[model samples]
Target: MISTEQLAGFRYVQDLQDQPAALAATLDSLEASPAPGDMADGIVRGRFRRVVLTGMGSSFHALGPLHLRLIESGIYSLLVETSELVHYLPALVAPDSLLVVVSQSGESVEVIRLLEAAAGTAPVVAVTNTPSSTLARESQFVVETRAGEEATVSTKTYVASLAALEWLGAVLTGAGVPPVLRVFRSACAGMTEYLSGWPAHVESLTRFLEGVDHIFLVGRGRSLASAGTGGLILKEAAHFPAEGMSSAAFRHGPLEMVRPGLLLCVFAGDLPTIGLNRRLAADVSRGGGKVAWIGNDADLDALRVGVSAVEALPLMEILPVQMISLVLAARAGREPGAFVRLAKVTTIE
Candidate 1:
């Protein structure tokens, strides 16, 4: 069993515990700063032909929900990684397009390169944790996540960015800020209630994860945010090999790899696809792989994240994966989220 002392020794765990407060602070910042009037007006007036969302790592994953929202609202939206956007798709940074860039540090190499390439051609909306970074200073509008300093692998910053992006999506889509704000507050409370049981969660996950050598996080819709980010953090924090992909995509090819010693954590996403996700989980189990269903109705208590609103589900879906990370770290006898080779910010390309 992982000891409380061991968990407390890592700054990463502390950051994980601090997420609810970071989320609350992000909501407060959103209320205080509001979306830029010109940007919102341009979006509503159709002055911009498209919206391009770009970021790296967890920041990129956090844009999944917003990208879908914009598309559903009939606004053309492009989701691209900052690196690929700078090197392969520079033309997308035209004045006719609006860019939404997310970065915790805001000074990562690709972000800096993109900012230089854009050169004020497009109106940039920056959703970042560092208020004073170049991405914030150079952008036409800024939504500060206010997640504070993260010691290593992203926890607070990722959720904070999600909150900020949700607010941004509501503003750009004219979806009414009051409702989104209410969801944000609810998500914060939900996160606190869920995280309050982290120790027990970790202990329970330790048993579920035993003898597991492979991990995959799969979901659809907004839950893609958690799946993608969860896979990234599992590797970064626990030095474990894992993959995150869409549920449909998994059945396409990766499903063949399912067998004993493999664990699949499936997110029962929004209502439209929850039934499909449940089917996928059942298939994985029948194929002899362990399945952890992440949802309110999960059979395993360790996997159940009690979320009220569908809007709040994405934020809560990630908690189970975080618990798994802790368990993986303890099994490997390493300090979770302690970097052996990576820095918090990527300075090199």
Candidate 2:
């Protein structure tokens, strides 16, 4: 229940609020038409020498989970941006490579160029919202996200791409994915719950973030999807400067940048790395930096949004950051994601 007073005509805020339905619809569309064609079967069987995942912006970030999952499931995968895949790494688009491309519009310039570069060599599995766009038309296997229309600055499409990629991961890994899908169902409600508390979440996080001269979003594993996208959208939607990097990377040099007005949101992600992230929070605090732990383990009630399972963590993790962007926009007296110069779709590489 976000009021208009807070949005400042920020259409992307509506896009963010549309996520619950968008996710449900995308999941339903995926379930209703769950077939990946013969090329995908070969890739799933590890017949391909390499599997390359390519996209740009949030679409690229959404592939983080699937890329890691494919590697863990014994499928050799490389996560490369479409721009890189098309020009510099065209050799990687070999006959034995399975290319998985994600784009909500499916007509972005990079996607078109990647399709041209990989045309006859690789078997492509395209996950996109548009059924007739270049990516969909050129792909051998299409996994349509069905996120519908997004105005500006990706929100629904980002979540929907993540959902579509999750489904793709399940199909390739042959894992028991009923619980995964169930967790997706829970994610919609989790987001709805968070959005319902939007007024409070915005005010509190804004106040928490007040006087924060710089922002750093850090996370590990799948949470990196949120961390990376969160940091990007804060800049796009709020025009605020933020950096999203790995928790380990932050410790190397950026840790010294921690001073008053510097706020770090550390994702206490999965079990294997959660402890390490928590320790980083402790170390940041000891170094006089403000640290906010995110995840079920976060000590603050405001930061902890209940996620149903680890499968749902990526979807859950971005909600608070979305709130931050809205508040930042309102504070700056601008519409969130109103794009003063940037276009919704990247028409040029």
Off by over 4 Å in 1: none
lDDT of 1: 0.90
lDDT per residue (tens digit) for residues 1-349 in model 1? 4576779777999999999999998889888875677887888788999999999999999999999989999999999999999999988989998999999999999999999978769888999889899999999888999988899998999999988898898888888888888988988887898888888888778887888999999999898888999999999999999999999999999999999999999999878998999999899999999999999888767688877776777789998899899999888888899999999999999
The CA lDDT of each predicted structure is: 0.90, 0.85
Residue ranges of candidate 2 with Cα displaced over 4 Å: 1-9, 44-46, 299-301
- Please state the error at residue 108 of candidate 1 in Å: 0.3
lDDT string for model 2 (172-196, tens) is: 7777556667889888888887777
Would you estimate the TM-scores of all the predictions?
0.98, 0.95
lDDT of 2 at 237: 89
Error of 2 at 106 (Å): 0.8
